[model samples]
Target: MDYKSYPVVENIFGISGLNANLANILMITVCSAIVLLIGVLSARAIQMKPTGMQNVFEWLIDFVKGIINNTMDWKTGERFLGLGLTIFLYILIANLSKLPFVITTEPGHVVWWKAPTDDPLITLTLAAIIIVLTHFYGIKIKGFGGYGKDYFKPVPFLFPLKVIEEFANTLTLGMRLFGNIYAKGILMALLVSLGVSGFFGFFAAALPTIAWQAFSLFIGAIQAFIFLMLTMVYMAHKVADDH
Candidate 1:
């Protein structure tokens, strides 16, 4: 798997060396637009009795509510419903996008799309955003003094350890998602390479590719749920009175 970076425009205008993966960024943007569209369509016309897209959206909202409610009370959790819903929908769409057929000349050179979550920069940025938001809320709920005091909890000796834990959480959260999705992409690339060998190789690759894609779908859903659940849990730790 070629893990090398693809320049955003190879060169923007006349200048060179603007580091960006435009393909991944575009995929993320497209996924975000799709999620937004679905949200709008779902609520375009509210029915006296919900049906179709409305029902599906309602169910998903309820499911996200449950994640928040599990970690904290509905009162506090409901405040973050938008974040939870957006993360789940966007990640799900991005993850599954790779499953569709791609007419590419080579593996890993998929032009139009790649899973956004598979990119470490995207995943880490998301993790940092969630972590930073939690800190902001912590400061809001607990005074600055109260929030700072958390690092010295149990014993003053553990202050450094507690501080380091924050960094650890950010890295683990981002890398876990990136590693899983990236591995799936790499596996798909490998399968594609095998299929290109010859006619026999193509048939041999078919079943395994289908199986792995199915399993990758399951992993994607589970990862999305895990990310949402972890976000809520982190928020709970920051906002709950007991913490």
Candidate 2:
């Protein structure tokens, strides 16, 4: 099947190309809204003995804390507990949200929503943000001059290599997510094409699609965890005194 990207803002702004990844933007917005709503609702009624939404949210927070503690000391990592929690939950939601087949009015054009992580722009933007924050925190903790001197530690010639390493990390972190999620999208599209080809093809692809969906959920969760873990590692490397 031919592919055509949708631009949710195209009509309003008449922009395309990088601006055309609007569906991913919309999905990210939707996921953010849902996450915020869940947080609000869960916190609306707090009890000494937590249950249901409160319990789940607390558990999630502790789980994220565990992840942070694994990478950094509790004192330093606790400050980032919320950030880690938000990234993990937001990415997890974004990843699995694409599993449902969208109803579309036209072929090629994306439906109202798509997985934000499936878009490199979205993933790379997130990766860049994470790296930027790492630099910020490094400076905040170690002073601007201290953080700057890190690039040339043990030798003055390693500055360029260090810069290249940061760029590579950002590219790899983002592309890894986009590649996996995009492959899942392609698999879904192929299965859909198969289902539309003939009665026999429909039967042949139906079960496989369902099976793949289950497997994709694992992939999605793992990617989210990997992203979260890497983010923590990058942050730790920047802020830690060990250099």
Measured against the true structure, the TM-scores of the candidates, in listed sequence, are 0.88, 0.88
Prediction 2 global C-alpha lDDT = 0.83
Best by lDDT: 2
- Could you tell me the lDDT of residue 107 within candidate 1? 39
Off by more than 4 A, model 2 = 1-20, 100-102, 107-110
Pairs in clash, predicted candidate 2: none
What lDDT tens digits, residue by residue, belong to model 2 across residues 121-154?
8899999999999999999998999899889987
Clashes of each: 0, 0
